[model samples]
Target: MDGVDKERVQKIVYEMSKGSKYFENEKRKEATINQKIEDLRAQCVLLTDEQISFYQTVADKRIIDLEASRDLSKTWLHSDMDAFYAAVETLENPSLKGKPLAVGSMSMLCTANYEARKFGVRAAMPGFIARKLCPDLIVVPPNFQKYTYYSELTRKVFSNYDADFIATSLDEAYVNITDICNDKSVSSEQIASELRNTIYEQTGLTCSVGVAPNRLLAKVCSDINKPNGQFILPNDYKAIMTFISSLPIRKVGGIGKVTEHLLRDVLGINTCEQMLQKSAYLCALFSEHSTDFFLSIGLGLGGTDTPQHKLRKSMSCERTFSATEDESALFQKLADIAEALSNDMHEEGLCGRTLTLKLKTSSFEVRTRATSLQTYIHSKEDILAHASKLLKAELPLSLRLMGLRMSQFYDVKPGRHDPMQKTLKNFIIKDASQSTSCSSYSSDQHLRNGANIDPSAAEESCLSKFESGHLMAVCEPEDYQQSNQIAPVKVCRPGNDASGIKDNADECVPQVHADNEGRSNPEESLTNQNGKMLWWIDDYICSVCGAELPQCFIEERQEHSDYHLAEMLQKEESLNNRRGLLQRERPVVSLVGKISPVGDVARKKQKTSKGKFIPIDAFFNRYKKD
Candidate 1:
C-alpha cells in the first residue's frame, strides 16, 4: 500500500477507537473499526497510489481505482456479451463449434464471429460472398424479436439487484448498484466476479466486465478481454497511454477506411503515436472538428458527463449502386429502391413530404436534389416518378451510386384526419387504374409504352383540340418542357379524364402524348435536300398553348424500352399533313377505350364484308356511358 493510503486507514481506525461509542458499546465500535481496517487493507493490498501529485499518473490511478471499488460496493453492474449472436448460435448447435458463423438477412451480413475474421468475412459483406469465402460457414438469420425478448428477461434479472442499470441496446447497458451491497467495505472486483457468476448461472452466454473510472474507460476495457473475460484500466496517464498506443488508428471510433488511407497511406502515418505527433498537420488536413476529437483521444481524455439529446428526427438507409450508366437500368434500380424505402417507411408508420434523390457520379462527385410537396407520399411509383423528374433535369452523367432519402417527417396518426391522405389515396387509385388499363392494352399499343411523343403531332393534337375550344392545357410550359425533354412515359393529370371531360376525379390520369424526341432523331428530318433547318421546333407542340401532346392519348408504358424517336416523328408529320389526304366526310372517331388502326379501319372494313362495322354514334354513346 502507498504511505498516504496507509496513513488514511490509520487515521480512520484511530478516530473510531477514540469515539466514546467504543466504551458505551464496545462491540459496535470494534466492529466499525475492524470494517474500516479491512476496507483500507484490501485496497492497500491492491497497490494504492505511489505518486500523489495532482494530474499525476498515480493520482489518476487512485481515483480510477476508487471509482471501480466504489461501483463494486454497489449491487448493480453492466457488461456486454461479446459476439452474442454468433456465439449463441454456435453454442446451441454444438456441432458448429469452432466454426465461423454470421447472422444477417438476404442482402448483407450483420454479425460474424472471430473465426470468420480469418477468411476476411465481415459484417455488411454480401451474404453470397460470405458463403463463398467459407463454403461450410453457418449462416444464421437474425431473430431480433426473439433477441429482444431474451434481452428484456436479462434486464429483469439485473433489476433484482439494482433498478438503476439499463440495457442500452440488445447487447449492452450500465448499472448503478449502490443500495444492495450496503457495506461499502468490499472491493468492486469481488462484486464484479459475483455478478459475473450470477449472470452465467442464469444465462448460457458469457460477458466481459470492465470496471473503470467512468463509462468511456469501462467500455474500452471491456473489449480488451474476450468472451468470459474481465478487465479494468486505472485512470492513470501512463496506463492509459500504454493502452492507447497499442491500438491502431482505425481502432479509434470514427476513423473509417477513407480517413485511414488519408492518414496511413497518404500521410505516411501508421500508428496512433505517429498521428498524435502530427497533431497540427492532421488537424489542418481534416478540419477543426476531427482534429479536436483525435487529439482528445490521443490524450486519453474521454467524456465524463452524461449524454443528453432529443429523439432522432429521422431514419434513413442508403447504398452505392454497383453499376453506372445505362439510364434504363438506373431507373429500374431507383424504382426498386423507392419500393424498398416506402415499405420501410410503412413499417415504421411514417410518411414524409420531402423526397431527396442523391446521386454519386463515377468520379465520386455527389449531387442531391429534394422537392417538398404539400402532400405525403407512400406509394413506390409516386416516389420514383418524382425522383425521375429530378433525375431528368440533372445532366446525364455516369452514375457510381444513387440513393433516395425521404425526410420532412410528419407524424402518421393512423386514425386521425390526416391531410396527407388525400394525395396518397389518389396515387393508390391512379396506380390501380393504370394496372387495369395496361392489362387491356393491345400488343401493338403496348409497344408504344415508353415511346417518345412527337412534338409536332402533340402540338397538332393540342391545336386541333383547342380549335374546338374544349381542351384546356393544365400543364405549365416548364412541366411540358421537362416531360418532352426526358421523353417521360407519362405526364401528370390533364385536369380532366381521357375523354376531356373535367370532373372531380381523385385519380391523376397520366396523358400519353407523341414522342417529341422522334423529330430530333438522326434518321428523321423536316429539312429538304439542303441541310437548312425547315422547322423552328423539330418536334411539334401546340404553338399557342405549348402543351406538347399526342393526337391520341394512351398511358402505361412497359419498362426497358428506349424512346422510339423515329416512329413517333413519322406519325407526327403524317398528322400535321393530314390536309393533303382528301376526305369526303370526316368520321367522328371516339378513340377512347378501343383499339383502332392508324386510318386503316375503313380500308380493312371494305376489304372484308364479314368485318364487324359499327356506326360512329355507337362509339360516341359508349364513350358517354364510360
Candidate 2:
C-alpha cells in the first residue's frame, strides 16, 4: 500500500465515518462502481476472437500514430511545492512545523503536511475522519492570501528561467528549460537544482523539481523524490521507456481512480508495460481519445510544448452553505451570486451566451441546468433573469451548495476587427442610400429643422441604439468609426428633381448623388436649436420604421430597423390574440417548422370565429348600451 498502513487506517476511517451522510454517499458510489465493473466484465466475456483481432489492429495503428508525433528534443521541468498550503501556514507560525497539520475545516481537508500524511491522512479526505486516524492532527483554517503571496515569490524565480512558464496551480508549474540549458551551457538537472535553491532562498519554502524530456515524464519524476528534492531523467529514449514501463498507470496524470480500476480489474493491466501488452482490448473498450491517451502513456510520450498564450474557457463562482429548504432564502442567495458573477465578467471584459446554474442538494447530489442566449450578456440584470428562470424550474430544492458558471465566451477584446464587418457595412450603406433616394425634400427639411443633434450626442445615441439592437454581428464600435467619418452629409440620389432646393442654390453645396439623383445639395441641413451641427447623414434612415437614425455607418442603421421590426411583430401578435384573430406565423416560427399542427388549429379557430365573434370596439359599445 505504498508504505501506508492500510488496514489500521481503514479501521480508523470506517469507525469515524460510519452512519455519516458523507460515508453513506461513498457507499452508494462504491456500489455504482462495482455494478459498472461487472457490466464491463460481462461485455468482455461476450467478445469474439474476430472482434479482439480487429481491436488489436486499431490499437497498433494508433500506437504508430502516437510514436510518429513524439518529440524528445525539448527539456521540461515540473515544480511542485511540498504540502503548499500547510507549509505556508507553518511558515507563518513556526511552532506548528513538527506537529501534524491539515488545512481546512472539519467537513473537508484541502491539504495535509508530511507529519499528518504519515498517518495516511491526505488532501480531499474529510477532516473529521482524518482526526480519528491521527488524534494529534491540528486542523488549521486555510489562509489563501498567505499561500498566494508565497506562490508569487516562487513564480518570480520561474520567470527568470522560462519567461513563458505554465502555472498549473497555486503551487505547481511546468517550465520549459531547453533554451536556458543551452544558453547557460548546463544540463537540465543543474538548472532544476538552481531553480529549487532560488525558490527556497526567496520564499523559505521547500519544493520538489523534476526535469525530463517532456511535461508528462517531468511531472511524474517530480513526485519520485518527495519534499525538498530534485530528480532528473536523462534525455535518452531508452531511459524514458524503461522508467515508464514499470510506472503504475494510476501515477500518470488524467488516469483517475475509475480508470485505474478499469485497467487493473477488467484488463489486469496495472503498470505501463501491461497497458502496452493489453493495448488491443483497451482500443475496443475505450473511445478514440482515451485509447490515444493510454497508448501515449505506454509509449512514454507526453506534451513537449506549453501553450504561449492561454484563453480562459469558463468562469464560475460557487459557495457552500448549511442545507436549507427556504425558497426565498435560496433566491436571495442566487441573486447575490448572480451579482458577483456579473461583476467578475465586467471586470474581465467578458460576455458569454451560455449560463449554467449548479446546485448540490442536501443529499450530496449535484444538478446543473444550462440555458443559452442569442446574444452575449454581461449585466447583473440579464444574469439574474436567466438564473432565476433556471432556479424556478427546480424550485423547492434543498441545497447545500450553489454556483453560477458562464461559458461560450464572446471575444470582447476592444479594437479587434471582424472579417464580416466590411460586408455588413456595404449592405447597410446600399440599403440606406436606397431609402434616402425615396425620401422627399419635405422630410429632409423636417429633420434639419426639428431634430436637435450634436456630434458627441449623436455618436453616443448611435452607440446605445447599436448595443440595444444586438448588432455585434455587424461591426464593432471602433470598426464603425474607422469605416465611416462622423460628419453630416446629405445624400442625393442621381436623376432626382431638385425643384424644392433650386431656389436656395447659394445655401447648398453641390454634390452628385449616386444611382437616382445626379444633381443635389450635399449640405443644406440646419443646425440643432443649440446651434450645434447635427452629426446625421440624411441617407441613413430605417426603412421599416421610416425613422431617421443618426448613424455614421449603414450597418448601425439596418440594425436599428431590424430591432423596430421585431418589436412591431411582438406587438402585432399580442393584438391579434386579443382580437380572437390568428397571428400570421410566417416570420416567427419554432426551429422545427414554420407551419406546425398548433398553428393549423389556431388558423381553423380564427376562420370559424370570424363571423361569430364581435369586434373588440363593438363588444365594448354593446356592454355600455346594456
Candidate 3:
C-alpha cells in the first residue's frame, strides 16, 4: 500500500474535487506553477555554455561560503506533537482513538490522524474531499480552548529542556539544547528520549523528536520517524551532509508545493544532492536570495538560535462569516472586530499607531488598507474611528471576513524616573500650602494650595461623566480585581486640573466642554483647559514632533520621529515652491549655530527668523556634518 494505493486516492480526490471552487482555484495555481516551470526550462535552454559556467562558478562560491558558516557545536531539536489537534480530540474521548479522524469543518481540514493519512486524507484538504477518500473519516470541529490548554502543558515540558524554546505553532517548537547536553553530560538522543517520555507521561500525548546540529536537519529528522518516535543525527559533518544528499528537496521547510514542482520538473532536482549539482541553473533561474536558500539547504545549514525575546510585530483579531452584501451589517461587523482588537491590545498592554483593515470579499479576494495615526490607540472608540474611515472609503464592499490589526506599539506604563512625575512633583511642591505634605501627599488628598480637594465631589463628577458616556475606563476591570494590584484609573473633578494624580499625570485628559446647545464638543475639548493651543503630551507623545502617540510600549519613537522629519521636508518643499524658489537651488540653512555649507549666515538668521519654518532634518543634518 506504500505507492500502489496512491493513484486510487488521487482518482477519488480528483473526482470529489472536480467542478468545485476549491478544485478550480487549485487548478489555476497549478497552471501558474506549470507556466513558471516552462519559463525556467526555456531560460535554461537559451543560456550559452559560457553563461552556464559563469553561474556555476558563482553558485560554487556561494556553497563554499554557506558551508564555511555552518556551526556543528550546537545541538538543535525540533519537537512536534503527533497529529496534535486529532490527538487532543482522541485524548479527550478515548473512543475516537485508532479511528480515521480529522479536525475542522467541512470547509477545510485542520489536521488528520495517521489513520486518516493512510487513506491519503491530509491537513488543508476540504473535509468533503477527505470523506470521499475515506468514507468512515470522522470530522471534529476544532476546540481551540482545549487545544491551548494541552499546548501549554506540552510547553511546560519543553521549558524543562530549553527555557527559550521557539514555539512555531501550538504543536511544534524548535529548541536549542546545546547547554542542556553540555551541562548534563548526556547525549542528544538521551535528552530527546527523556523529553518524549515526560510529555507522554504528563499529557498522555506522544510527540516526535529530531536532534541534529541545526534546525533544518532536525526538522527533517523529526518527520522520518513519524508519530511517537525520536531520531538523532550525529554532529559529524560527513554524516549530516550525507543524510541531506539523498533527502528530497520537497522535505525541506521553506520549499513549498510550487517550488518543489519547479525544482523536480524544470531542474530535475529531486534530492538535495541533485540541487547542489543543478545549483548553477538554479542561480541563473532564481533571485540571489532564493539561490542562496537552496544552496544552504543542500549544505544542511539553518538557524540554530531561538529568538525568544523578539517583540511581536503586530496584534490582530479577525473572524469569518457568511458572505453578506449589506453595508450596515458590514459596518457592525467592523465595529465588532474593532472591539475584539481593542480587548486583545488591552490584555497584552499594547497600543499601536497603525490600524489595518483586512477584508475578504465573497469572491475570496482580499483587500487591505492601513492608516498610521499621530498617536498610539488601544481603545474601542479610537480603533472604530480609524477602522470605520477605512471601511467607508471602500464602500459597498461584499465581504466574507473582516479583521483589525494594530502595529507600531508603544508602552504606556511609566518608568521609574518618569519625566511627567518629576514635573508634577516640582509643581506640587512649589504650590504646597503650610499644612500640605508635598512628599507624602496621597492621590485622595484635596489640594490645599489654592486648589479644591473634594473626593466625594470629584467622584460624583466622574460618575456623571461615565453615565453620560464621556468618560471611558482606561484599564480593564480584571486588572484591578487581582489581589494586591494597584488600580490604574482615578477620578478627577471636571474643570479642576488633576495633573498630579499618577493615572492622569502623563495622559491626555480630554477636557469635555459644553457648547451653547448644551451638547458636548470633543473636538474643542482636546485643547488645554486654559484655552491655549498646545500639543497632547501624553505618555504616547512623540518627544521630537510633539504629536500625540498611540502605543508607546515598543521602541518605535525614533522611526516615528523620522516620519515626522520626512513630512517636514515635504512641507518645506511646498513652502519653497510658494516663495518662487526651486528646492534644490535654495541652499539649506541651519536653524541652530551648527555646521553650514554657507558659513555663519545660516546661523545669524535663526534669531531674526525665530517664528519662520525650520525643518528637523536640515537642523540635524548640519549638526551631523559637524
Candidate 4:
C-alpha cells in the first residue's frame, strides 16, 4: 500500500470499467446521488433564517443530550488482520509471499495483499480489472474454511484479552479491555501491543490494533496505521476532539460513499469538524438516527461498552455470473443457491419464517421480493418452493445475480429434515389442519384450503429511516381489506407426527403482484394510459389509502402514501409501538444494490462469496446470536 500509486490506480480502474455494465450502474447511482444533492440544495434555499435559527436550537439541544451520553471510563481496542484472505493464502504457500497476489475468482476479488495494492488491486474489485491493473498478480480462489480456522485461532487469542470481544468479520474485531487494564494495572497501549504479539504467535498472521475510549473511535483508529501497526487515542476530551477534527467522514464506519458525498458536496462538510458547522442543516434534513451520528462524530462520541450479542436475524446466499436471459439457467442458479442456503441454515441450526428473493438485472439494478410464511422452514424444498414463486413473478428475465434471505426467526424450532409433502400452492394458501408437519412445514390440509396464489404479494415493509431512495414510498401497508401483514406471532408444527427432510426441491408461477416501490414495470403502463393500472401500484391501488389513482398523479399519490404512513404510525402508537418496532427491525425491502445480509446464526458463518465483492456498498450487516 505504501508504494501504491493512488492516482494511477484510479485512472486504470476508471478506464477499464468505463464501458462496462457495472460502471453504468455506478453512473446511475451517481446521478441519483446528484439529484438528492440538488433536492437538498432546493430545500436549503426554501429554509428561512427563522427556520435555520430554530434548527440550530434543535441541533444544540440534541448535541447537549448526546454529549451527556458520552462515556470515557473504558478503553476499547479494534484489531484488524492485514489483508486477511490474502495473508492467509500467503501463509499457506509461503512462496507466494512478497509477490503481488489476490484472493478470489476472475470475476471478483475478495482481497489483495499489500504488494498487489501497489498495482491498484483490492477487495471487491473484479479479478479481470485487477488483472488489467497488474498482470503479474497471482489470483487465488478463496478458501473460507481455512480462513475460518485461522479466525478461530485469532479469536482464541482475543478471548484471553476480552471474553466478550466482538468479531465483526473474519478479519477484524472490537475488544473492550477496561477490566483487563484495571486489573493488570497496565495501560491500553500495553494491552494492544501484547494482544497483537499474542495473536501473531497464535495464528501466524500479523494484525494492526487501535486503542481508544470507545468502539467507534477504536475502529477508526485501527485503520489509521495500516498493516502490522498500532494507533492509540487517549481518553482526554480535547485529545479526542483534536484527533477527530480533521478525520474524513468516510473513514468512519457506517459513513459509506453516498453518505460521504452528501455530507461533502452538498453541505460542504469534508471533515468531522465541518459536520458540526453544518449541524443545523443536518438536523433539518436527516433523520434523528443519522443526525445524532453526525453530531457524535463532531463530538468524538462512541460506545465504550461491549456490545451485547443479538439474535441472528437473517442468512443469505448469492452468486454473480455472465449475463443471461435464459429462464431455465436462472432457475438452475436459484436451485443451487437454495440448496447452499438450506445447507447453511441446517448446519447453523436456524429456521426462519420469512424468505426474500434478491435479483440483480444485467443492468446492475437490484430488485427484491419478500414474504413471511406461517411456519419456520429451512429444508431445500420449502426454500425453493417459496423462492421460485418470487423469481417467476419477475420474468421474462435477464440477470447477473440472484440471492435468497430468511429472517424473522421463530421461537419454537421446526424440524427441517422433511421432504416436500405439499406443493407450492399449499404454502401460499392457508393451512387449517391441526398443524403442519414439523418437517415439511406444509400438509395436505394446506393444499385443501388453498387460495389462488398471487405471485406478487404484500411486500415486507417500507421501514427505512434512511433518506436516500428517490421515489421511496412510506411503509406501504395494504388497505385493510387487502392487508397481508403476516408477522411471525406463532409457530405451528405437527401435534405428534415427525417428518423426514430432503436436500432437494422445485416450484413457481408468473403472476405480477403490486410492489411497495413505485418503480414502473416494463410490462405495465408507466403513465396509466386510459386508466390502466400501474404495475408497481399495490394490488392495482395505493396500499395505504386504497385509492385507484392514475400514475400521472405522482404528487397526489405521494401525499396519499405519506398520509398512510402517518396513519399507520398512529395506529402503531395506539398498539403500544410494538408493531412499528418490529417492522422497523425488518430492513426496508427495495430494488437497489444488494440488501446487506443479516448474519450467520452459528459461529462459523457460511462465508460464501458471490464469487465477487462490490465495495460500492458495505453490506452483510452481521448480528451474533446470544
Which candidate's TM-score is highest?
A: 2
- Cα RMSD of all models vs. native, in order, equals 26.3, 14.9, 16.3, 20.4
- Residue 436 CA displacement from its true place in model 4, Å: 20
lDDT of 2 at 381: 80
lDDT of residue 82 for candidate 1: 63
Mind giving the per-residue lDDT tens digits that candidate 3 earns over 37-106? 8898999999999999999999989988988898999999999999999999999999998899999989
Q: Give lDDT tens digits, candidate 1, residues 1-626.
A: 11224444345445544544323455554465566555534543454244112224433443344334432222224578767777667656788778888888545788787787566567777676666566777788987776676567667666765554656777676655444445555555666677677767766667778755456556666666756787766545577678768667676556776566556654556666665665544443455567656565555555443343222345455667665688888888788888888777654434566888888776555689989765445557778888899888885778867888887553211222244433211221222233111111221133245332333333343333223321222222244456755211221221112422122121223222323454432111111111121221324332222334333211100000001111122233233224332122232122221222112322222222221212222222222333
Clash count of each predicted structure = 18, 7, 12, 4
Better of 2 and 4 by TM-score: 2
For candidate 2, which ten residues in a row score worst on lDDT?
Answer: 588-597
Local distance difference test scores for all models: 0.49, 0.66, 0.66, 0.65
RMSD of 3: 16.3
Predicted structure 3: lDDT: 0.66
List where candidate 2 sits over 4 angstroms from the true fold.
1-4, 412-626
Judged by whole-model lDDT over C-alpha atoms, candidate 4 comes out at: 0.65
For each candidate, what TM-score against the reference?
0.45, 0.68, 0.65, 0.66
